[model samples]
Structure formats: C-alpha cells, structure tokens
Target: MKINLFPLLFTIALFYSCINNQSNKNDLTPKPYKVSKNFIPINKAPRIEYNTFNNITQNQYSFTNTTSNQEVSILHHLDETGFHFYQGLKFKDNNLGVIVGGTRLRARITLNGGKNWKEVSFSRFANSFQSVDFSGNNIFIVGASNYIYKSEDFGKNWSVFDTKYFFKENQSRYQKFKYYKVRFLTEKIGFIIGEHERHSVILKTIDRGETWKIIKNNNLPKNEKGISDIAIISADELIITTLSGKCYKSIDGGVNWQLLYSGENTTLSSIAFFNSRTGFIGGSNNVLMYTNDSGKTWKKIHMPYGEISDIVIHENNAFITTSFQALDEAKSFIFKIDSKGTNTPLPFLTKKDDSVFFEANSYAIQTLNNHIYILDKNNLYRTIIN
Candidate 1:
C-alpha cells in the first residue's frame, strides 16, 4: 500500500496555515472587558465646603474606587441650603434622579445624571421629606408631619395620600403617626413604618396607594423608639430596625411581628439583608449586630467606629459608614465587611480627610452600574469595589 505522503503533507500545511491565520486575526491585547461606569459629571466645579459644628454645607465630594483605592471622581451639588441635610437619594437611571431633604419642603430632581439638579416644588407637602422609594413607574415619598405622596409618572406629578386615617378621629401629637421609612415590594403591595407617641405603627397598602390599613399586631412594644429602617425581602418576609435598637421580623406581610432582637441603650439606625436569611442591623453608639437564622438570634460584632449609620451589601462585600457621636471627625470611617463578617476598615478617607471637612454625615450607600455612592446631607461620593 502506497501512503499518500504528498496529500497528507498538504493537509497538515493547510491546517497550520489556518491556525496561523486565526491567531493573527485574534489580537493578543484584547481590550479589557469594562463594566459600565455610567458616570455623569457635575456641570460646575465644586466650591469650598463649609463645615460648622452641627451644620455642614457640602459643596464637593470625592471617592476612592474599591478596586484601585485611588481617587476616581468628584461631584459637586448646589452651594445652597436645600442641598443640606439630605434625607434620601434615589437615581432612576443613569440620568433622572430625585433627592428629598432640607428645612423647607425642599426636594430636587436631576435630569442629566446628577450634573444639574433643580428643586422640585411639592406644593402639597410642607415638611422635611424623609425617605423616597420607587417601584416600577411609581415613586413614593414619606416624611415628617405624617405625609406620603405618590407619583405615577416618575415624579412629574404627585398626589397626596390621606394618612389621617392612621390616627384616630381626634388629632393629637401622641396619636398622629410620624412616618420615617417606606418600602414597596411592588406597585400595589407596600409598607411604611412609623410611630405615634406610645405605639409603633406599620401601615400596609395592597391596592397601590388607593387605600392603606394599619397592620394590627399586639406584639409591638409601647413607647418604642419607632422604626428607623425597613428591609422587604419578599411579599411575606419583612424586617424592621428601630431607633431603640430592636429588630422585628414579620413573615406574613406585616400581619404579625415577632421580637427578633432587643438591646437596652442601643439605637439601630439602619438595617439591610444580604439575603432572605442573613442580615445586619446598625446604628448609634457603635452598634453592629448580625443575624443568620432569619433573625432568630443576633450577635454583636466588635467595630472600632462609634456609630454605624448605614450598611449596604453588594454581592459578598458589605460596606458600612460610621461617625463619632461626639465632634471628632477623625473617628469617622468606612469599613468593608466581607462575607465572614470580618471588619476591615478601608483607607478611602485618610487622604481626603482634612481637619475641616467631615465624613461623619454618611447616612446612605447605594450601587448603580458597578459604582457605589456614599451620600450624606451635603455630598455624594462615588467608588468601586473589586
């Protein structure tokens, strides 16, 4: 048998030629796969920040990305009072946004990814706005003086919902429910937690704000510190942290609540769940508590910082911001807690912290398009992790 050496050599040569051609087509330096930053720059450069004892005029903000821990971006807002004491921040997308805060009925909206922000004049609401949450196309704002407003068209127009029904027929300070935080699981199902003088109130609306009813639960304590933050895991599972450092868990869509954890002289300012069963409750006096058995029990974690004002989980990492109850800005810090609940303070603030500028006002942290934002009354800092 004569082996066809010529044809076999020809086929081998063709195969090597095809391999070389494909290798040449593939560029060795493939562009790094970039997760979108979705950054929107501020139109005006930031002005000098003014920091008094209790008052802070946040004119500028800068952040250290978690991946590099280097200065990435700085954003500036208005050099006015309405931008002070920011109660809440929510960005609908890379462009449209809303922030509710200030002494007067000061709420503002940004059209171009927070480059320029304009005051949203809500004629019907006259008190300081506290919390804002959006579900689908509906936006809900709740605040001091027992008021809740709903917007159907992304905050263009808002309608006031009658919260007067939460109180008795008689109008009294002890009877009036002062709402603090709100969360909506869907357009129709939502929950708002607040407190009267002696009673903690949880209001539920199943009909998309058309009607709201008080969740009747005799389990809540009297003269409680009130619900400061709430995390809605699903239609049935709900968790709320109180100003008095107590956590309540409700499994039946606010139908009933059980005491998850309680501590004397501890105030929990914020609560967040990494998942349905794991969560953390944080607040003043350097309190940071964790629960893994669906709030059945909680263990206190040792933290060097004084007050844990906010806790936000992104994947396996949990970011927390803290400040001194006293007037020491040096103690203010941000710590990145890993999945094992190990506290490692990120040095993102060491370089930026001047004796005058304070990082203590961090009240909220949010993530959008792989960028994390730390927000307070006067400033918003952006960064990245991993």
Candidate 2:
C-alpha cells in the first residue's frame, strides 16, 4: 500500500474553507452601538408640579407655586406684533436688544429692555434672517441665500457678505445655502453654521466679521445633516448639535471635532453649557438631555410631549422653551431645569385660540438680568425669574 492520504487531506481543506466563509459572513453582520446607561427615568427624577394660567383680559400669565398655592405673575412684557415671524433674539445688555426674523426680512430693536420694540430697516438681499449675535457694537445676522449682514452701529446700517464665495468649487452644485446660527465666542472669533442641500458647513471668522474661512472638510464629521446649534464652552472648547440629533465637540477652536453623543433619531435644535462640565441639549420630540461630565456621557430627562425650540442657561439653571403643533392643536410651554435635574414648567402657556397667538412654532430664548425674553411667531414675551 502506498499509504495514500488524498481523501483525508481533501476533507481537511474543505473544512477550513467553510470556517473561513463563516467568519466573513459574521464580520459583515451589523452590530448595535451601545447607548450609555446614564439616563434617568421620569419616575425617578425630581419633578415639580405647577399650574399654568393665561389671563387674556390682563394680557398676562402666571404659574402657581409647586409647594404652595401662591400664584406668581411671570409675564413682565408681551409685544404683539402682527404676522412677523421672529427667528432669533439677542440682548447686547440689560437694555439694548435686537430681534431678527422673516416676513420680508424684518429686524426689531429695543432700547428699554423688553418693554418696547421698534422696527429697524436693513437692506434686504435674503428673505429671512435666521440668527443674530453681537460682539460689542458689531451685530451679525445670518439668513437664507448665504447672506451675512454685519452692522457695526448696532443695526443702524448693514453690509452683506455672500458666504457662497467660500464654496466656489461647489456653488453650482447647490441652489442655496441657509445659515441657521451665528455665534461669537469673542469679539474676534466667531462661527456660523449652515447647510447647502443638507450638507453641513462651518465658517470661522478670526478677524471679526471682515473675513471667514471654512473649517477643513477633514476636521468635521461625515454627517449629511445641518448643524442646528453651537455651544461655546470657552474659546477653545465648543459643542454643536445637529438636525439629526448628533453632537460634536471641538476642543481646539473648531480645528478638530469628535462625535460626542449620538441622539435617538431626533433633531437637536439647541445646546447650552453653564460650565465646562455641565451642559444641556434640547431638540424635537421632547428630547432634553444633560451632561455633567463635559460631553463624555448624557442623561435624558423626561419632558412633556413637544419640540424644544431653544435653551438658555441663567444663574446655573437651564431655561427651556417648547412648541408643539398639530393639524388641530397648538401649544407652547416654558420650563426650567435646575442643576440637580429637577424640571419645573414655568407658568407661561399659549393656545391657538388666544387672540395674540399666531402659530405654535419656534421660540428664541435669551436671558438678561433676571428675566427671560422669548420671541415667538407673532409676539415677544418677557418673564421674570427669581
């Protein structure tokens, strides 16, 4: 016998081939990313119960104390401007403020806090202005069609900069670009976030608003959604929320970014940080999350069914505004979240049937002194917080 081992060798080769094929098939299968276990359930979190009341006759609103039945009037001022949809509100100080909006590119200024507002005219190249921010006397407003209007005299005059020049190579590929938010970390450094056809772009201005440079393409995440909001913790550390509920953090002054948190398929509209380690993110579908360890982990807080339009932190407390709309109903609410994660709904409420209520859309929130100014679709509301 020649001790032939051909059949045995063939069997061994066939077995190894099957194992290799099975290994590759396993590798191709998708695996779920592990969500953090830091979320606090609604039942376990501290919640305050307060009654909301709106007095149509007095043009005021009030919230009842959670512990006591004492009614406290919160509505300090309400400006009912007809049909003008305000998109962004910012206060340069306790007295000077500016609000930019749509409905033929309207801009309003108030010198006496929120007590009175007057329309300020500006040259219109875009139909709407989405965001407004100020660095000293230089006010920057960004809007549709890649237009950025800068006013060195505080909305007295305007100079427009078409950001399309930054994207000259792909300008013809997209019809228009919309800038959602403009944030100035300091007088000389600022950022404008927007998208051209759902692809997000961030522009950095190092020399005030005179010039801008696009953040390097390789430095940003490979996201295809718009950047909804930016939270600047410091000149070097910053965080941004996206339309698809993604959060990115840049510690090197927007030079390099890393994905901080992946949201649960919601649109994160606003993000604000009270300190370097504490932050809050709000978005669509009642998504409100907080992080205490910078951006390392996040904990979701239970909120009423509504979309969070804007968030602002005052005195270490987060003030949130929410708007909910449906075919037959519309509602808006203001809530406050303390540092301990306690949620208290401020007594401000609006209904579709109200004479002053126009639409339950977005609310731009700002805090000055001890008051919160909210710019709604057709009205401006100022509420005192103590």
Candidate 3:
C-alpha cells in the first residue's frame, strides 16, 4: 500500500511547503511544447541510465521487451539518492513519485515517471508514510501523523488539508500509526482505511479532499476490528471487509452498512464489486468468496493457493495480486480472471525477483485514463490493459 519514507523524511526535515493553492499545472502536462525535451515515452523499452544527480543506477522506469519481458514499466527509483525514500507513484499522462531531499529534511516530488523531480516539503519529519492517493488532479499524501497534504497540477504545488473535521483519535495509533491503503472512486467521493482499532478509519469527501467526514463507528453490525480494505459499488452501495472475515455492504455510501457475507472466522483482506449484486472477496490462506445475488449469499471459489491480498473487477476482468508463495515459490504473483476467480498469472513479468521490492508483490492498484497503475514502494508504473 505504501513505501517506507524514513530516509526521505530525514532528508526533508528542513524543507517547508510550496505554493499554497495551485501553481505547477504547467509542470505536469509539458506536452504540445516539445517531445524529446519535456517528456519521453518507452516505445520498445526505455534505456537504463544512471542519474548523476543522485549517483543511483536503479531502474527508474522499466518497460519489458524480449530481453526485458512483457510486464508494464514498473518504476523502481524516485530520489535517485542512494537512500531510497520512495513514497508512492501516480500515473496520469505522466508518472509522478516522491523523493527525499538530502540537503534538508524534505521529500522531493518527481514527474514524467521519475525522469525528472521537484522538491516538495510534503512529508517533513514523518515516521512513516501511511498511504497516498490521487484525486481531482490533486494528490492526497498522508503520513504517520494526522498530517495530510494535497498537490495541485501534478506535483508542482501542494496545500495542506485539515483532517480534524472528520477524524478524532487521541491514542498513539492516531499519532504514530501509518495508513495501509487508500482508494478514490470519484474526485469527490472515496474512502481511506487503515490499521489500529480507531485507526481503522473511513473518510468521504464530496468536495474532493477539501474536507473529510468520518463514517466509521457509525451504527453497524460491528466496527471494532480493524478494516482491511474498502471497494465502492455506487453512490449508494460500497462493499467493505475487515480482518475478521466481516464483509459489509453500504447501500447509503458509508453512513449505514449491513452484512453481505461472513464466515465467523474468515479474515477477509480485500473485496470488489462488479455492479451491485455481483462481487468477490479475498482473504487469508488463498480464500476467494463470490456473491452473485447482491450480497445475499456467497460461496467460496478455489483460487490460486496463496495469500490473496487484493482484487479488482472491471467489466468481466478480475485482477488479483498474491502476497505469499503458493508452496515454496515465495515470490509474489499477479493473476487475471474473468467473472470467476479462475485466473492465469501473466507470464511476462513473473520473474524470480523484480527490481523494486514488490513490483511482483505489490497490493496497491488503481485504474486511471484507460491504464492500470500499480504502486510498488515509491515507484508507480502503468500499462494499457490488453
């Protein structure tokens, strides 16, 4: 869900904020100006080159070919600093990720998919980066504290969003906790769920991230256990699962929720919806549960024998990422399915080990602009789903 930002947090300790509202709209979309200068696209593959600025030679942007492979380009480096303080990456027309500043304590933001970067004092003195998400061309970046910042025009300018309107936590979990996952269904509507009892929070923004409202702890079946993840079905329906195998469907956004699927002892980590009645849930021990009659009842499907971390449904396509090894493979995997949980792992990117830690093991996946994006550590990579 997020990469460690400890190194970057130290780097950007002295750095402060940028322009408050909006300024760098120009920095994100440098197209129509120049081709070979502002931005570059990986055709066959992008040549791996060392960045002298930071003296790092890691794969900044990777596009697989014959020798390379068929997996979409997965971003590996963000700061180019020997210290990898990569937080998360976002893919629009261009890809953007965060880097840590070495001179002062500040995190640098990179665009054009890590080819270039700009320093932004976004994460200052943060213990860890909880989670990051993109909405309304605005970047909502959160860390170990109650801090949350929004970037306008890609990563050029940023503004802080006061999360106190919808959040109230006095325990150390709120002060020292980190976010595990974030999701944005619409620019103005979405949710972010994380760890800790009270930290298993849910937020909704009708006016983008300009403001937030907490819908957790509301009148529900039970809201004690930590939430694993959430998937939006519609304006009135959203499917959420907890680590206790408690699966709930919210017919009124998140205001009121009801149980759709449960097994008493199933630790469901991920859930996705096709329309309203059709959905799937993934949990511990390679378990996959499906509901065809709109959450009325569910039956388990034998998925790949492994720890299924997350699942995504688009039309008839279901993309799943495996966390643990099936047996002793130990390496992470990606599988695609149609309607049912039966899926074939994409052979192109399945290697012994990837450049980044979890390129093959990542759990953060977002679809935008007709492309599926995955965030492994601080790098963000994308591909046109074919």
Candidate 4:
C-alpha cells in the first residue's frame, strides 16, 4: 500500500512539472508588435536613392557636383580664436544665413549663401552663444549667463536682454542660467528652454524678444533635469524633450504639460515634426523613434550610430545627424529618413588630421531649396539633395 501511494504521488509531481515547463517556454516566445495602419512598418518601407561623399578631404574644399549626386563642399572656414566652434546656424533664405558659436561670443553672417562670412560682434556679457532663431528681419540668439540678443534689422544692431532678473534676484543665480535653445513660433511669440541649477527651465516671450518671463507651472516631471530641445506645433501647442528621455506636450502654451513618451532613460537631444501628426525624436544609444499619431505612440527606427545631435525634416524626408566618440576619435553620420520609414546614410566630412576641429560631435544641418548646409566645428559645408 505504501509503495502504491509513493508511485502515484511521484507521477502527479512529474506531470505538473512538465506542464510548468511548457508554460514557461510559451512565455519566452517573442510576440509581434501592433502598429497603426497609418504608419509604415520598417521592413515594408521603401528604400530611397541617395549618394554619400566619403572622400572629401579637410583641406580639399568641394566634392564632385551633379544634379542627382549629393555634394559636400566647404563654404567657409573660421580659423580665428573666438570663432573656433559653431553652436547654431539658421538660414533666412537661399542666399542669407547666420552661424553663432564661441570660444568667446562670436557669430558669422553670410549674405551670399555661405560664399562669404562677416564676423558679428557682441558686447562682453556672455562668453558663448548656444542657439539662434529668426523671423523676418528679427533675429534672436540665446547663450550663456542669461544673455538674449535681439536684432530687428537682421543682425545690424543688437539689443541684449540679460534674463537673470527673471530667474532669481542674485548674481550667482544669473550665472547658473544657461540658455540652450531659442525657438520663435511667430515674430511675436517664442519660447526658450534651458537650465537653472541643473533643472529644466522654460522662458516665454509674447512680445518678441523685448521681454521674457519664466513659465512657472510648466508641469515637467519631478525628475526631469534638463531640456534638450523644443518643438512648436503651433502658438498654443508645444513639445519638449528632456535629457532624461521624457517627452512632454503642452496644449495651452506651456502652462500645463502632459507626458507623451517615457524613453529608456536615454538623452533625447533633438526632435522635429514634419507635420502636426508625424514626427521623429533622436537621442543617445542609437535611439531614433518615429510617431505618426503625434506623440501618442512611438516606434523605434533602427539607427546605426550612437548619439543623434540634430534632426531636420525637409520635403517629406528627415535628415538626421549623429555622432559618437570612439577611442579618442569622434565619428559622425548623416541619415535620410523618408516618409515610408526608410533610412539611408549620406556621406559626411571625415577627419583628415588629428585635429579636433574636424570632429563632428556637435555639428548641425539645415535644408533649403534642395541644398543641405552643415555647420561643422569652425567650417561650413553645403550639399545638394537630389
């Protein structure tokens, strides 16, 4: 009788173990992701035709030009001490553009499409400039130590607004306010996102750049540290990406915010919307996400590079710049993403010497009239997008 009981109990235990094993195996199986019908799946997207310019040397200026072929040609170079780095670039049209940067507060303007650049001088208030934006004849530049430079006559005369008073009434607090990006929705309405003591700060200007006020109830997440970029859909709607990989949307002009996407703890450096309902966000760790339904949902797009520095969308194509440091060397790339979610890599300027000036870590790209203008370190390059 004892022997009979033992055999039966052993049999029952063995059967249950087999069932559990099968269940665990089923749990490990990969499941397919559900994508919206409006969005194209990556595997099913169409491939775009493009060319890469890999052989252009640092000293050698221009690449081979063709209608269908993309060319990377150096337009201008800044070898002076104060103009060794370029932080921001904005083109007013096909013929006029401005670039701002620093070893000290420095900017260069080209009226003939980067053929010639003239130095723009600033008062010795801020040591560096980070970003620039323009609407019509009015140009706004933001930079370190709470400096906001406004030029109503297209960089002819400068009016500086030191926003330290808007933050805290102290000198130390003024130094802590660093403006990273400036965006103007219209000639009169604009937003600036930066940092105050390592926390994200947003400043709003309803009267162009004449005056600014801090957006107090921005409703940013408690853990959000710094803001990487801001995208304005309209005067009332705005989106911002944080250094913590969180994206927030404000429908009521940044008075209140709603969390749209919480990323995988990576730094989202750039965001661009081709339209109100479709956009792309790029970040560290080769993270590139595309959302068709605004920011309600996002899908990962495979990127071959590590940090995405900037994203510019032109004519239904998204151009992305990414850079990564490798063994004391920096490598950069330019990728074109089409409406169908296809990604094509374009050629970028390679380092010809052991100099850091040619390293493409913080380069910027802008497209106008079928030409792509790139600001790389102290040099400016142009490429035709065919």
Candidate 5:
C-alpha cells in the first residue's frame, strides 16, 4: 500500500527588501532583448512510427544528416503505463540516464543510454516527482508533500525523507514544505526551493542530505506569489524566479538580495546558468530572459513558441521545449537554436495527418552524442541535428 499525504508547507514571499533597507522593486529594471518579429519556418523531422500494445503509438523523429544528407533515426518503446507521464530527465553520462514522473513515486532508469528503460517505483505515494537532480553519484528526487528521495548509487536504490518542519513558537500543526527544484553546488552544499502556505521557502543542506535548515532572510520576497525556480551560479551568487515573472539575485549567499527583473505576470518555471556570467530563465507565454553579466541586468529573448517548459544548454546550442497547461494531443514542439547568434523556435508535428499541432505540454529536453531527446506526454521522440 502507498502512503498518501497532504501538502503541508506553504510560502508568502515579500518582494523587494534588499540589503541596506532599500527597495529594489523601484530600481533594477529589465531590458528587452532583440527578437525577430517574424517566425522562422519550421519543418517536421522525418520520422518512423510504430504501433505498440494498448493502442499506444511510438514516434521516432528521423532527420537527414546535414553533412551526409542521409536519413537517420532510432526507436524504443517503454511501458507507457509505468510512468503515466515523464516530468523530469537527467543524464549522468552519454549512456546512463533517469526519468521521474507520475502521481506516485515512479521513476525509470536507462543504463545503455535510452535504448532500454526499466521502471523503478518507490513504495510510498510521492504525488508526482516534480524534479530530478544529480551530483557525482548522488541522485535526488523531490515532489509533492515535501517528500525527498535520494539515491547514492547511479539510481540503483533509494531512500526517502521529508522536509516537513514546524516553527518553534507555532507548533500547532506540522508545516511541510513541498520542494519544486533542488540544485547542488557541491557535495555538501545544496539548496531546495519550494512553497509553504502560499509563500516561498528556501531550504539549504550543508551536510549533504543528512539534514536541512530553512533559510529565513528579510531581503527575500514575502508575498503570496511562490518561487518558481532557482539557479545557483556560484557559492555566493544565487538567482530565483517567481510565479509573477519577477527575478531576484543574491550575491552574498542569501544575506542580501536585489530584484533583477519585474515586468511579466507569468510564472518562470525553469532557470539555468551556463556560467556565473551567463544565464537563461523561461516560463509561460513565450517568456525567455537572458543575462550576460551575472544577475545585474536581464533582457527578454523573444521565442517563437510560448509556454516554455524545459531548456538544456550545450556548448553553443540551446535545446528548449514548449507546452500548454491543458493537455492536447495536437501541439508539441522541441526547439534547438545556435546561441551564438539570433535564433528562433522550430515547430514540430504531433500528428502527421494534422498540420495544426499546438497544445501539448513538453516536459523534458535532453541531448546525448549529438542526438536530441524530447519527452511529451508518454511518448519520447529522438532526433539528430544535421
């Protein structure tokens, strides 16, 4: 039997109370990045389809090698029922990878890249794994109800723990904080961003996952809008995005903060730093923002697609996926762009017969060995960029 638990922790963020008791809410402003008003024409990648049991259809996106102009693709089918849906993807190497999703503590691992995958579900009810992160051999999976499962091995086995806690003076109820994203700066230093009681919460762990403590600082946001994601650029530098499209930065750990950007009303779901000097943040309604000189300033990067889901940055290329809140069978797209110059979103086809594919939510985007992997709903599509 699975253990069902309710969400315990909540948050209330207070926006803009930087150090020296100044309100950055009136100061720091974001500049809009140059974007092409014209949409780049997108062509569907050549694909091979397979019919599996239970009326499931598998799609393989094949593309001709740009250099050789020869078609190339591969196909692999997973028990679509095992994961229900894939929410996160993390690859340890070119071969080994893990995916987490579903209302339960469901996870799947692949040892030989993605040629094959095996289901590895936890015994407890985890309410859908929200995020999967790793560092060296440590694998951490966080989800609803403040439950956190960790694996020291290469996702072979797992251990479960919770971030539930109660303030000393107000111990009437057990306040559990549900974590959305976990980022590790080092083996022992890491941070988890989530919500508690409609406000934002940031938990830090110094002794690995053995114990965690809440980081209470006055400079942080204290409103009903919760934090969407976090990017730890360096040991002292940190940036976090909010549901209101507001961005905050801290140069001295969590001591002092500055409101970097505030203009949009949509949630910024994903954030990543290529380095301490370069970063990207994206979320609902074509909201893609970039920073060059750390978090001092930011600008909106126009994307052809809206409702940005996931983004993974390679050396000179950036892979992004977009999807909607309401699930639709028609719309799903994964975009690849050359970050060195101006780029645009590349559209994709979900149904071969229908040229009008647009409402599916893309969950994860990954790249390995020059091949791109995109997860939409229960189907996984693979393609190679020429």
Candidate 6:
C-alpha cells in the first residue's frame, strides 16, 4: 500500500534517459539557412556599361554598379596591359584577358583566381586584329583583313585560319575590313558576323575556324545588312541583329534566317538570349525588345528613355546599358532591368565624374564573375570596390 518505489523509480529513470537521448539528437541535428548576399538586385547602388563605342567621346558610361557585394571582387585592374582595348574573356583554371592593340597587336594576360596576372604576348601576328571568343580548349581571335587566329595551345602561339570570304577577292580595303566581333558556342562550331562595305556579313565555321564558308540562308532577304552581332541561344538557335535593326532568327545555325522585326529604326548593337525562349536586344532609339518565345514574337520593353547598347539577362534579373538616359539629361547609365521590366539605376556605374573607358562603343558591355566590364572609349574598366 505504501507504494511500489522500485518500479516507479525504474519508469522515471527510463523516461529521463529517453528525454536526454532526444535532447542530444536535437542538438546534433544541422540547421538550414543562408549567410546573406544570396538575394538579388539588392545593392548599395547600380551601374551601367556600353558594348561597342564609335569613338572616345561616344564611349562613356553613365551608370555604375554601386552595390557593394563582397563576393563580387575586381581581381585585377591594369591600364597599361589593357592598352588601347581588350575584347573577349575566357575563364579556365585561370582567367585570360585578350587585348587588341592600336596596330593589330595582340597580347593575353592570365589570372590565377583574383590574384596576379601573367602576360602572354604575340607580337608577330600584331596586324589588323579584332575580337576573340572561347570554345573548350580552343582560344580564337579574329581581326581586320579577314585574319582569324586560333590557339589550341592556350594562347601560347596562334595559327591563322582561312576566314577568306573577305580576303578571297583580295581587294585592298574590303579584304582587310575590320571584323569587329567573334563568338563561339562550341569548339567545333562557331559564327562570325561583321561589317563589310558598311553592310552586315555573316560567316560560319564548321571546323573551329580552320575553314569557313558563308551561311547560305537564301530566304531572309537583304544581303547588304551588316550583322553587327550574334548570340548562340542554343546549339540549334541564334539571335542575329545588325546595325539596321534587322533582327533575324537562325534555328538551324546560320544556314537559314527569318526576319523577326521589320523596319526597326534604331540599330540593334547587342543581342542576348538567356534561353531559347527568352531573349532581349539592345537597340538605338532607347529600344529594348524582349521575347519570351525565342524570337518568334517580340514585345518592346519601354525604358521610358535610354539608348540601350546591350542587354544581359541573368536568371530573372535583366541588365541593360544605355548611352544616355533622357531623364533630366542624366547621361549614360547602367541600370538593372527587373522582371516587371522596371529599371533600377546603379549609382556605382552611373555616378557623375566617374571616368569610363570605351567611348560610345555601345556594343562593348559585358558581365563576368559579377564584375561589370565596359569597353566604351577604346579602353576598359572593372568595377572593383563597388
């Protein structure tokens, strides 16, 4: 009657042991979370950039990436090495920078992480050089006079390929016409488009640039249009825009093309397609057209007022850099274009009195490793602290 003390004590001890076991389990379990900076558009300020400049005066930046994201660091800044201009960036075990000199001179700089840079020079092939793009182990740069050079040797020595559509006839000026830009989606397949006689011309290479031929897409009229720039949206699709604001789609590589916009007044300087279905084009007249369905139908993204030279879409966030913003004569600026197509200006790139390179080269804006690059006034600048 007094009580079963031993049995009751045994039950209490068992319960305490189970409670201790559960508490220890809870302590050992890992918690789920993030350490900030993962969020988007969040910034102390925003910036703007240009892609291709007409001249020094035409190549100034008004907007800047003022957002002080710590992870985004400007690894290196070299005014001397960059020289007159630098084009095309390739990131491998190291980051390589290809600089185009004033007189067809070409040099490359390699970076280990964000540390020091190693300069690789090629003084021999320094005549009439242009732009560069990467495909796996192959590094390629093309220049004026139909000079296309490829480096399977990691920028050590380059082999000149026969991109002879321009030089074939061997005319003096037209033969060495400055081929402005080159892009490669893969090592084996790539496309080159540039101005020929002030008109857009398209070139295709099947063997990485060893040999090339014109993309005989006979259907899309106007052989005179100069294809100023092209982007590989996918292996099978491409968004081709020219100086004439002529937007063409080539789903089967460059073999065929179809006009998506007719009579677009402003010249489209740069084109970017995040996916096969989503794309954006920066054109004159402050026009930026976005298409959700590849290039089938496009809707103009009204920027209120800015001459957008290039448009870059990273996930849901879209970035457009303009020559100048009409708002209060705000000057040229780089602002973040959001999902709703609204514009958020970055003070870092657009801040007044902040000097910019690559004048009005509205076609020279590029984003890599979160650092903003503007090739405006025949020079290049990196957003370091900002």
**Top candidate, metric lDDT:** 4
lDDT tens digits by residue: candidate 1, 238-282: 888888778888888767788888888888888888887887888
Give the Cα lDDT of each candidate: 0.65, 0.69, 0.56, 0.70, 0.63, 0.56
Off by over 4 Å in 3: 1-71, 78-89, 96-109, 117-126, 162-178, 195-199, 221-223, 264-266, 325-332, 342-348, 351-360, 376-381
Q: Give the TM-score of candidate 6.
A: 0.65
Cα-based TM-score, every candidate: 0.74, 0.72, 0.67, 0.74, 0.70, 0.65
* Location of the lowest summed lDDT over 10 successive residues in candidate 2: 45-54
- Per-candidate clashes, comma-separated: 3, 0, 12, 0, 18, 50
Candidate 2 per-residue lDDT over residues 1-386, each given as its tens digit = 68779999999999999999989986775433222222222123222111111222224455543322444333233355454567798988877878877645666776665455566534333357789999768888776655566767755445566665665555253357788899888888899997877788888887876777778645665655888899877777888988888988888877778888887768888998888788888888788888888879888888866689898889868878777765644445667778756564443444333344435565688887876677666556665566
Clashes of 4: 0
- How does residue 289 of candidate 4 score in lDDT? 87
Residue 48 lDDT (model 3): 15
**How displaced is residue 11 in candidate 4, in Å?**
99
Which is superior by TM-score, 1 or 6? Answer: 1
Kindly list the per-residue Cα lDDT of model 3 for residues 238-277, writing each as its tens digit. 7788877788777777777787777666788787877777
Judge candidate 1 at residue 132 and give its lDDT.
75
Candidate 3, residue 320: the lDDT equals 72
lDDT value, residue 170 of candidate 3: 35
* Model 4: CA > 4 A from native: 1-60, 65-68, 79-83, 121-127, 169-174, 326-332, 342-358
